[model samples]
Target: MDTLSKLFKNNIRQYGMIIALVVIMLLFEILTGGLLLKPINITNLILQNSYILVLAIGMVLIIITGHIDLSVGSIAAFVGAAAAIMMVDWGWPTWAAVVASLVVGGLIGAWQGFWVAYVRIPAFIVTLAGMLLFRGLTMIVLEGQSISPFPSGFQKISSGFIPDFGSFGTNMVAVVAGIILSVVYIINELRDRRAQLKYNFKVISQGMFLLKLILLVAVINVFTFMLASYSGIPNILILLFVLIVIYSFVMNKTVMGRHIYALGGNEKAAGLSGVKTKKVTFWVFVNMGVLAAISGLIFAARLNAATPRAGTNFELDAIAACFIGGASASGGIGTVFGAIIGGLVMGVLNNGMSLIGLGIDWQQGIKGLVLLLAVAFDIYNKNKRSV
Candidate 1:
């Protein structure tokens, strides 16, 4: 019992946020009269939130390193416009255009990183400047008009669904994928538990572990079942999954990841300990640029156009998702998983409210309140711990 209690305390942030997500989902599900989780709606939710999820992944890393990027939205917009021009106007191949766009994203990150990391400009100021600069560039690139009718291949990046094989009246591919994921999750958890035990680290009781496993398995299966019922998985959903897995591994099992946390915890100390704060900071922003670029492409593809006003206020949503997912306002704390949950929370709220006929204005206000509350909760938790 004591060990279980300790485990719970140690993981309060993760567990709490997850519980809050479940509660919010349930609330919205009920309010929407069961429409929130319908197969079609579930598919739409994943598609709609895919880009935000991508941004949240990168933003969580930025926050983890005790920095923030205010220009991701603008960068995304600019990259989208650039891609549109390359593919639609310049007659570039779809594959080449995407590759070029990602490279541009990286270059843009390097540019901002040079200012923030080596030049000693505050990230806030540099990114603020970047926000304005990129937005203007996007406007100029688009000539204050929208570019449309991207190549069919580019359009498929966002809207394509996986091919379904014959199954028991569902997408057999989705069902099989779900089962595999559930098994993988259980194995990972067990492996983690064994490692904790080997190191004499505290772990939850076996009963609690089993309970968690069951719940996770159930959730994954149900979600996959829904998707199977509809369009089987989306290509974008697969992309998001790959990213989550890769980033989660990078953050949890890599030396660079540890260094990032150390940097955020205490920069001076990290520097004293020989951590290359500047390089790390620079690379972090560069990576942010790459993710933002991917987001831009996805968004543009989904809309089948690039507009001058594309990506307005996207930075806010990404930041909010990171915070709501349990990233510390002061940095040195957060997780990739947390960011996904946070994005989903926002996604669910947006979808549910829209279904119920709530106006966009009300949705914005409510989202603001939720963001405020999440930050407050985090601060309160920190203060309580210090006390």
Candidate 2:
């Protein structure tokens, strides 16, 4: 009984976002007459939530460090506007626009990092000022207008998909690739388990591990088959997949990642213990700025345009996703997977409500209530356990 209770607690801590995802899906699935899980909707959900998921991952790290970034949306708008101005207005190459946007994002981050890390201003104050500053900059750059008709290659950033394997009706290439991926996944899982055992960490039972593997394989195969049936998969989905792998690796395997975790857990202690707190914090915001820029560029690409209101309220969506994903408000706890799950939750809600023809006002009200409940639950759970 004690072991079971411990297992439950552990699962809650580790997989609360997953549980919430399932609950939300069920609620919407029932409400929307099973529209939520349609394969098309599923694919759309991934695409629609991709940017927020990206931002949430970075935001999770930021919040884990007991800081918040309010300027991401504005930064995104500015970056998108810059990308558009460079590509369309100035006739720069798409690649040039992309590189410049990312660089500018990093510089903007560094600018804010200067204040937060060296000047010792609170992150909230610095980013709040940044929010206002960047928004004004965006408007100035665009001069109260929108830019459009970007190059085709640039437009493909968000709208392009990989080649369809289903066109061949049982394309051997996709099947072979799927098999290879499954084998690689199994090997990696085994190696991870062995490493955990070697380090004397608590390892799950082989049965449970295999069960998880089987479920994971099932989901992957189903998804692969569906994509192969449609247009193989989206290029942006592939980008997101690569990012997940890279960020997951950084968080789990790298010394830098360890420093991030430590800093988040306790800044003063981490600083005293030689974690280079200022540099890490600076880099954290820098990374966030880069991602926000990337997000902005993608959003602009999707619309084939940039507007003054581009990315309006996007920071709220990203931060809400992070909090909903189970990152502690006080800091020091979160995961990439959790952020993705949370982003999907919001995306699904938005999509499902739209499918049911909920007006914008009602949708916002509903989402606001849900957000409130989620945060309230998190706080209540924290206090309850403290007692």
Candidate 3:
């Protein structure tokens, strides 16, 4: 019992944020008259927030390294415009166009990174400049017009659903995948617990561990059921899942990841400790650019068009998601899972408010309040701990 209490205290922020999310979800779910979690709505929720979630992933890493990228939204817009010009106007192959767009995104990242990392320009100034520069380029590329009617295959990147097969009228593929995922999660948790025990690390009691596993598994199965009832999992969802797994592993298990955290915690110390701060910072921006490009492509595909205004304010949303997800404003603290939870919190709010017939003005105001409160909560905890 004491062990469980200690575990809960140590992880209060994580558990508290999760509980907050659940409570907000429940509140909205009730207010929406069950419309918020309808099978179709659930699918739409994933689709609608997919791009933002992608941005949040990259942004979280950037924030972790004590930096920010205000240009991702603009970069995404530029890439989307570039993709549209290539595939629609120039008749390039969809695959080739995508490759080229990603390359362009990388190049853009490299450009900003050069100034920020090596030239000693602050990341804020560099990305802000990039934001303006790319937004202008997007307008020039599109000539203040929208490009549309991309190839059918290009559209599939965002709109396609995994095909269903096997017995039962439902999507057996989704069901099976859900079961496999649950088992894998359980195994991983158990393995981690065993490793902790071997290292003589403190861990939650067995009963609490079991309870956590059950709750997680139940949530997974319920979500899978929703998707199975619809048209199976979405291609974008698959992409999101893959990204989450990969980034989570990278941040939690890789040396580079630790270096980033160290850099964020104290750049001078990290550099003295043999961390290549410049290279890490440079690569971080480069990664951000690539992700922004991919997000741009997904956004463009979902809209079936590229417009000059595409990705406007996306940087704000991504930054907000990272902070709301438990990322520190001063950096050196965050998690990939936390970012997802934060994104979902925002996503659910958007969907729920829309369902309840709230106007955009009210929605924005309420979202701002929620973001403020989340950050305030984080600060309060930090201060309390210090005290």
- Model 3 residue runs over 4 Å out of place are none
| RMSD to native, candidate 1 | 1.1
Report the Cα lDDT for candidate 1: 0.93
TM-score of 3: 0.98
Which digits, one per residue and each the tens of the lDDT, describe model 3 over residues 313-345? Answer: 899889989988989989899998999889998
Q: Which residue pairs collide, candidate 3?
A: none
Better of 1 and 3 by lDDT: 1
lDDT tens string, model 2, 1-387? Answer: 454457767657447667767787888889999978776677677677777777887888888888999999999999999999899999998898899999999999999988998999999999999999999999999999999989999887788876544346744444555677788898999998899899998766777788989987886776676555544566788788888888888988898888988988999999999999999999999999999998898889888899999888889999888787777788887777777777887887889889888999998898788778767878888888899
- Model 2 gets an lDDT of 0.84
lDDT of 1 by residue, 1-387 (tens): 898787677768777888988898888889888998899999999999999999999999999988889999999999999999999999999999999999999999999999989999989999999999999999998999999899998999999988887657789889999999999999989998899999999777788889989998999999999999998999999999999999999999998998899989999999999999999999999999999999999999999999999889889999999999999989899999999999999998899899999999999999999999999988888898899
Best by lDDT: 1
| Model 3 RMSD, rounded to 1 decimal | 1.1
lDDT of 3 at 308: 99
C-alpha RMSD by candidate, in order: 1.1, 2.2, 1.1
Candidate 1 similarity to native, TM-score: 0.98
Better of 1 and 2 by lDDT: 1
